[model samples]
Every structure is written in structure tokens, then in C-alpha cells.
Target: MAWWAWLLVQSVVWCSAGVVAVLWWLWVTKPHVDIPGPPTLPIIGNALDFLEHPVTVNKIRDFHRQYGDLLRFYAGPKLVVLAAHPDDIQHVMVTSKIVERDPLTTSAMRSFVGDGLLTLNGSRWKTHRKLINPTFHSELHGNFLEAFHEGSLYLSELLATDSAGGAAPADVHAAAFSSAMRSFCIASIGVDPDRLIPDISKHEVSAVMRRIIVLMQTMMVRPWRRSLSLLRLSSEGRAILMYYAHLRKSVDEVIALRSAATEEGPAKMRRRLLETLVKPGGQTAIPLSEVQDELMTMAVTATDTTAMLMSYTLALLALHPDWQDAARRELKDVFGEGGDYLRSPSLAELASLRVLESIIKETLRLFPVVPMLPRILTEDIRLSGGRVLVPKGTILYVAPFLTHRLPQFFPDPLKFDPSRFLEGRSGEEHPCSYLPFGLGSRNCVGSQYARLEIKVFLATVLRRFRFLPHSRWEDLENSVLSITLHTFKPIEVYCVPLQESGL
Candidate 1:
């Protein structure tokens, strides 16, 4: 109604618009280091590109090619620096003491893995590293071999039966593979893997395994897409929580079994960790619950991972019969057709056969069971190339995917050539390269156990039946959940009996 009132209102509106304009300029000029990249969007960043091919390893490789070694990429709203050089990776691993596995990851993975070594950090982690290091000592290798032998033999028998019956092929359950491998590891610590499984039958176990795998699959699919109406509902979100409950209950049972077992036989002997867990500070007082959680952790991380890897390796071998044939021939030459190189072969005897070891190395290169290592920086740290300054809270990721396939390191990187690992050489011609199980202090502690399990499974199966893929190479594709790279199909193959070698 009045001229003065109208002018006052107009002044307020103009001030608000001016503030918004200045904020936009600051947002537009946010510094991004020049490492090549395909165009990135304003707010969402590379979230869509990541979800587009999270299951396949190719997406990560493309980032390496387009962005160069130390490029910046965003997942959801978080900025992550992907490291390509081993030196830069080790720098990140060693320099920052406070880096941790992503908090959201630990919370979600605790759905299945629990608070195992895979997720633990800082002082607790150091205590764990100090305690378990001795378990893998050279002398103790014999004690672990018995469990590895028995479990591997059981796996061997399983494949043999499938070959004999000529049943429809199997999809290779991720949890079952993980659980079974962990059973072997658990048994070495005096707990039976199967008995630890709560009286469940093979059929029931497989069903439970499938459920857990599906829960993780759902997480990957619904990732940044959780804003969608369906996923936001009470029913869909509630289902994920239920899966976690069952997983926790099952792991808790196994942990109890490990806790109850006493120190009598070699299997029952507790390493340094047991002393800290069961008998703290020479008091001889046992905190049985931590022991239980530690046992669960090992099982949760170790079992599914090794199984996924073995499954992937088998699928890859089926796809490439030439390598499969070569591996089989090598096995026959050394073990003399089902002679059990696994049970009684001395380290010297095993080492004499260089070819067998080479194949294992190559399998690791192509299908590194765990493709990515994720950490959050606690402090600002400089990498080898001054261009990359890793700041606190920046989630750092190092992928075996890019390093394993780099053309500079391994010639014609995608091709499966076992000879590249001949004579204990780096599969990659590139230095600080080829980290299938990672390196330095933070390397996969179960590397030895994984190698033994995979070798035994491959050796025994190939001896019995030659696996030939049913579909074309193009049909083979990987479907990943969390960390493991795996096939979505049954990995169908014909198991032709070897006439000369009696298996």
C-alpha cells in the first residue's frame, strides 16, 4: 500500500539473490587436479558410472586409463583417490596410521563378517597382527596341513561325486565356499567346521548360503539407488536386517565352539592371540567372548573369499581349456595321477614342480579374489607423485584390477598366460606390481591357507574330470557383491573321465 514498504521488500529479495550468485562461483571453481577423466557432473560426481559396472572389473580399469595413475573419483558424495603405483599404495598404507576400513562398510559387513580382523583397526589391529603372526610359522605349517588336507580331500570328493553322477551344474554358493574354507581354518584351531555349523545338512546350508549372498547382492543394487520408493519401504529394509540376525546367530555359535575347546592337542594350542584373548596379561583369565568374535571374523572373511576365488578360477579354467589342459598335464607329471601331492608332498617336492606354482600365480593375477582395498585417511599425506595429497577422511582405494591388467607390466594383460609367473618373477614387468593378496604389513594373513586350498581343489578335480565350458567366452560375466568377483551362471562343463590316470 505504501511506496516505502514496497522498496524495503525489493531490497531483501535482491540481497538473497546476490548471496546465491557468489556461492555458485565458489562451487564452480573447486580445484580438481589434472589427471585425465571423462566428464563428471556437478553434484552426483561419478556415482552413476560406478554403479553402471560395479560387478565387472572393467569400470575400475577404465578409470585408470582415463584418469591416469592418481585420479580423483567420487562414489556417492565422497571423494576417493585411486592409486595405481605400488609405491604410492604402500606409501598410503604405511604413512597414515589412522586410516580405517570405511565405517559404513564395517556396519554393513558386520551384517555377515562381524568384527573380524578384516574390519578391526588401530591398537586392537596391532594386537591382532602381533598375536596371529606366529600361527603361520614354518614349523606350524605341518599342523595346519592336516586340516588343509582333510578339508581339501572333502572338497575333492565333492567334485568327484558331481562328476560321476552327471548332475546339473552348480552355481557355486559364495557363503558355502567361504564357510567351508573357514571350517578348515577353524578345525586347525580345534573346532570342527561342519559341527560348528549347528547340525545343518548340506541342503539346508546351501539354502542359508544363498540367502546371505542375495542380501549382499541387494545392497550393491540398491546402493545410491536407496532413495527409490521401493527400497525405502519398511518391508524391503527390514529383510536386510533379518539376514544380519541369522548371520550373527550362526557365527556366534561357531565362536562358542572355538571358545569351549581347551589346550590339549596341537590343534587346541593357542598362539599369542589366545593368550591375550583367553588369558589376559599372564593372569590366566579368559575372556571367551573376544575369542569367539575373532574366530567368527576369520571364518566370515576367509571362507567366502577363498571359495569365490576357487569358483572363479574353475570358471576361468573351463572357459580356457588350453590352460586347463596345461595345468592338468603338469599335475599328472608331478603327482602321477591322483597320487595326493596335497597330503604328503614335502615343500621340496612341491617346489620342484615349477609349472604347478606358475598356474596358481596366474590365477591370482587375473581373478584376485579380493579386488579392492579401502581405507580412510586420518591425516594429510603426500604420495610419491606430489600431485596427489591424501587428506583426512578421504576414502582411499587401491584396486588389484588395474595393476594386474596394466599392459606395461604384463604384456597383452588380458590373456591368461601362466608362464608370466615362471621362476618366482613378478607377473607384471612393472615394479611394485602384482598384489593379488596385497603387500607389506597389511597383506592378507590367510594367503598361505588360500593357496593350499585352491591348489588341492584344482589338482584333485582336474585329475578326475576335464571341465569344458558349455557356453561361448562372451557369455562368461562376473557378478560381484562386496569384494568377490564371480560368475552368475552354473559354470557348466562336461567332466570327461581320464582313462589312463585312475581318479
Candidate 2:
């Protein structure tokens, strides 16, 4: 036995471990995509360039314009591939076994959203979808439609007040949008947020809504917090990683309150979303935790996204008064003097209101509710004549912002025309090209609710008043693509009361 022999063996072991660490570090930190980009730095990766612009979709467009359809970017240590072409998106969404929603994306969602069907995968997503599908069934759509109509009526009443002695233009986003959307959300989930949550202040709801946006920004900007994640250390670029922690705590409280309230039955139900979730199980029963997760996600999602759409739709309608007038004509033709806005119109009824639907489609086209959804690679696969090693965990992002604006799909990409959708599959190109609610098996569960909400709001608003854009119209545009595509500037418009306004 010799001391030198033991020391030599120890040194050899230490050297081998160093080599392995270096290789692992290289693999983890290196940019994996062959797609051309503006190069990168050492440890931080291509994060700096990606962050240069607030909208991720813009960077994706730049890359797509240069590299075409697919380009690679890294945020901290994670690799992301941006795809917008319909075929490419189809592959990622439909599955070739190479791409699905990545672990990190799932982790972030599960962290913020809990185990709502949105965050689940495979059997889990499918199972939840089956159980929850019936919730939207059983005449609930009609009920939610009625609720949406009520909220919309309340909104129209508020806007009518703003028309007081003819105010030239009003800031709808600042005044009407947030409040109206909050009301709609409350009604949709079948609860009044003003009364249920601990604080009953509008300012309080507004503040939390802002926090949700901030948390979403943090998710996009500082997506991967890396090694310090364990200690919960804030990295240089991590924009409010700590904020999400608190965000979750607040969500947990909401969850707790919801659980406690259910002991009393339907009358005690504080969330209409809860009504939808449990209404399906009926005598059978369902998981309240899962329902809570869906509710939490829907509350945040419903508030932010619906507000964004309402603002955008307002601006678009203002820009195209003809479409607004046409929709009004159609409404009058169908419902007459005593028609109910709350009732769910038949498929034919919805179909006949082609212009309204077109305007809605156009609004969604110009500014998608959520610009992009990130998918992950489940297995290795090939796309667009290239065999890229997708591995088991690569992120694939599909941007509706880019897809909707594609020149091939819609001519004069920037122009606002409701006729595009009015054409209705006749000479219309690319079915998968314009998906605002997402598509396939995992399409948004609340899409039916969302669409009905929009229609009801549009019906109530247009029936009563016409939106006249103030000077702020040009300034209010959706340039940011965070959790939802939204206008950085508040939209201000004049409320012009119609005969229906009782003015």
C-alpha cells in the first residue's frame, strides 16, 4: 500500500469528472439549431438578441424571413424552433413523434396554471378533455351565452353613459374594456369577481390583472432560470421569476376559497367556470382540483385575452364602419324589435350573420388573442425536407401573428377587410393557417365560450352605440406578443349612441 498510489487514483477520478462536466455544459449551453442567426455569446446564449425586441413574434418573423419558416433561438439554456408555415405547424401539433410541448414549457404552465387540461399531455389531456367536454354540453353553452349577453348589456349601459352629451371620444380600453371584460369573465365562470375575491375593489382586480401580465412577461423573457432555479435565485435577465412564486401563492388562495364555498351547492358557487366543470359529472362527480386549475387558468386567461380582443375588435370596427352597419342591419333583420341577445342562435343563424363573423375573423387575424403557443418534440423527426434531430425535448413555437399576416394567405396583409372570412372557404386558402384558438385535439376548451362572448358583446355594443376612434387610434396597435397579443397603448374612441341606446 502506498500513499502516492491512492493520490494518483484520486487525481485520475477528478480529471474524468471535469471532462464529463465540460461536455455536459457544452451540450446544455450550446445553440443546437443549424438555422442561421446573428451568432451568439458564451454563457448567456442568444437571449440578448431575442430580448432586443419586446415582441417575440417580430424576432421570429425576422428569422423566418431570413431562414424561412423555421429558425432556431436559445433563451438561457433552452433551445426553441420557430415555425409558422401551416404544414410545419401541422406536424408539430399533429405529432410526428419529434415535437410536442417541451418539459420546460409544461413546467412553466404547470407551475403557473396547475394541472388544468391545458398543461396535461397524452392520456391525461385526452381524459380530461373527455370529461370536461360534456361540461360545455348540456345546454351550458346557452346558459353561458345568456350570461355573456347580460355582461354585454351591462357594458353597453356603461358606454351609453360615456356618450353623455356626446363626448367626442372616450378611452374604452382604460374605461370600458377592463371592467366589461372582468364582468364577462365573472359571468362566464358564473361568479361575480367583485364579491367573491377577498378585495372587492375594481382597482384591486386591475392591479392583479397587471401582475398577471407582468408574470407572463417574466415567463417569456426569463423563460429558463437555470441552475439558480433550485435556490430560486433571480438571474440577470429573469424578469420577476420571484413574482410568479407570489402569483402562484395568490392562485392557491383563490383555489382554497373555491374549495370551501362548494359545500353549499349551486347557489354558493362563486365561479360559473366551476358550474361548467361540475355540471357535466352531475350525479357521477368529478375532480375539484382539476376544475380549480381550469378555473384559475380561465380567470387569468379570460380577463386578459378577452380584454385584448374587445379592444382590438373595437378599433377594427371603428376603422370599418361599413361592417358595423352591415352587422346591425343583419341583427335587425334576424332578431327584430324583441329578439333576445342572450339566446344561442342556431348554426344557420350564426351562419347568416356572415358579415359579423367576418369582422370577428378579421379582428382575430390582425391581432391574434395569443400570438403563439410553444410545442415540444416528443421524438426525433423530419420536416420540410430536412431530418433534424428533434430529440425528446425541443420547443417548437407556432406564431398565428405571422401566419395570419402571410401575403399568400391574405392579400395586402396589413389591410382591414371583413370580406376575407365572408368568402368562407370558397377560394379561401389554408385551413390551418389562421388558428387563434389553437387547433387539433388540444384546442382551447373555452373557445366556444370565448366566441359566444365576443358575439354577444358585439351584438350588445353595436346594437346600442357606434365606436368612433379618437386621435389615439393610430397609437393603439398590438405590437407585443406575450401571453396574449395586446396593444401597448390604450385605445380611446368616441361613444356614439344609436337609437337603441335610449339617448
Index of the highest-lDDT prediction? 2
lDDT of 2 at 176: 41
What is the C-alpha lDDT profile of model 1 across 255-365, one tens digit per residue? 454445564334444452333344322232223444556756665555666676666666668877788877776766777654343344445545565666787788778
Give the RMSD in angstroms, all C-alphas superposed, for model 1: 5.8
In order, candidate lDDTs are 0.59, 0.63
Per candidate, the number of residue pairs that clash is 4, 15
TM-score of each: 0.78, 0.78
Evaluated against the true structure, the overall lDDT of model 2 is 0.63
- Candidate 2 residues 303-397, lDDT tens each? 66776777788877777778777887887776665635334355456557777888888889888978887777666556665655544566777
Worst 10-residue lDDT window, candidate 2: 231-240
Which sections of candidate 2 miss by over 4 Å? 1-24, 27-31, 51-53, 56-59, 95-100, 161-194, 197-211, 223-289, 337-351, 386-389, 425-428, 471-478, 501-503
Off by over 4 Å in 1: 1-32, 50-55, 94-99, 163-167, 172-179, 182-186, 198-247, 254-289, 337-347, 424-428, 475-477, 499-503
Global CA lDDT computed for model 1: 0.59
